[model samples]
Target: MRFSLIMVAGIALAACSPPVPDSGQGVGFGNYEEYQKQQRARDAQLAGSALPPATAVSQETLAADGTVVASNDGSDLAAETQAALGQGQSGSGAATAAGGTGPQPEAVYSSGISQENNFDAVGAQRSIESDAAKIAQNRAQYKVIEAEALPARPGGDGPNIVDYALATTHPMGTQVYRRIGVNLDGKAARNCAKYASPDQAQSAFLSKGGPQRDRMGLDPDGDGYACGWDPGPFRKAVGG
Candidate 1:
């Protein structure tokens, strides 16, 4: 009974002593909260040191053969799809008629790019077809409604298709022969419509063709006026 009492008293004394620190910081284990904190820190450090296997962003992105598909951003989707299809054919024991080990690659098709950049947006195809179908009908109606009424037909197959080279009149109702490109390097080399007197211009115009002559591009607006030169004096003298 005395030995049992001594053993109990020794156990109590041991329990009362301060706990030793693991890191040898000379700091004894304090309260339960401090002990818990130290244990958590040690556990976290161990967890951080022993590295874990890297996990992929998505396992579905990998092909069945363990080759990583370069289709994370769908950049290689078409190629990957073609490869998968070929693999599928080979795996199915599909052989060529010549008894080849695997099926030969004939043509790999991808519906993704079948549009070929000519994608038909919603209603676009229907609109185009409708326009095409009604084009001839619309043209016929237009021709019937706007038929030209002429007193005499010109020397041509049709008025709409005039042979300008053979015809004399211009589209502007002026005589075609009057249209001439002039290169004036002398006599009136002025930049604009500068004239000493309108009489001189008027005389030159009448003799050669007044409105028909624009030697220096002076008549830019084609109002028979050149380089800011007024035709008032010329018009007045000629009663034009």
Candidate 2:
């Protein structure tokens, strides 16, 4: 009976006193390091890779029909001029030889530029070629009077000098030379109304202009020229 009473007392003591557990709960992962390398392998791979290739650009050109065209080859002014003049060569379909029954070409007016004309452009170039002294001389005289002034010879007793323009193809490379000269009249027949000759006064009035004539008062409306003189050259040398 005593044993049974003791067992019941122990059971009531155990039920009243609950046991303590471990009491630790999982709060997930702890805080990691503040900074960590993530893409090192990817960065190294990209750094080792080669770069992309460069692109090549081309030049621009034109067609005969006035169209803007682009090309990768070459372009020049001669081609453009030919395109402008509509003188481009025949395409693969057409025959290009003379008398080949192609469309009749238009009559092109070509002038015969004489050897003198050619020499005019070419000679000016050749004359300045090798001699540095000649170049310096030309530089010194460049628009200055290359020759001395000429006047009415010994007694000044002659008709007024006139401009004698000459055209020659028959002379054929004679190297003709010309220059402007004066016709000073030492003997004055009158006061202010003096001239080398009547012809000089007329040509001066016509070419040197009316204002210039007015300055000299040579042509007085049909009154008469050779009435006055400036005692100077008929024309002023420009930039000299």
lDDT by residue (tens digit), candidate 2, 1-240:
999999999999999997864334223323222112335666777889966556644466556798878765665655666775664453522544544775668999978796667967777766645577777878987676577676646864433422211111222223233212232222223322455665566545545443223334443432223334232233322211
The per-model lDDT (C-alpha) reads: 0.52, 0.47
Steric collisions counted per model: 2, 2
The most accurate candidate by lDDT is 1
Candidate 1 lDDT by residue in tens digits, 3-114: 9999999999999999876664335654667788899999999988986568734423666688765545654666778988989777675445456656567997666544
What lDDT is obtained when candidate 1 is compared to the true structure? 0.52
TM per candidate comes to 0.16, 0.14
Residue 48 miss distance in model 2 (angstroms): 99
lDDT of 2: 0.47
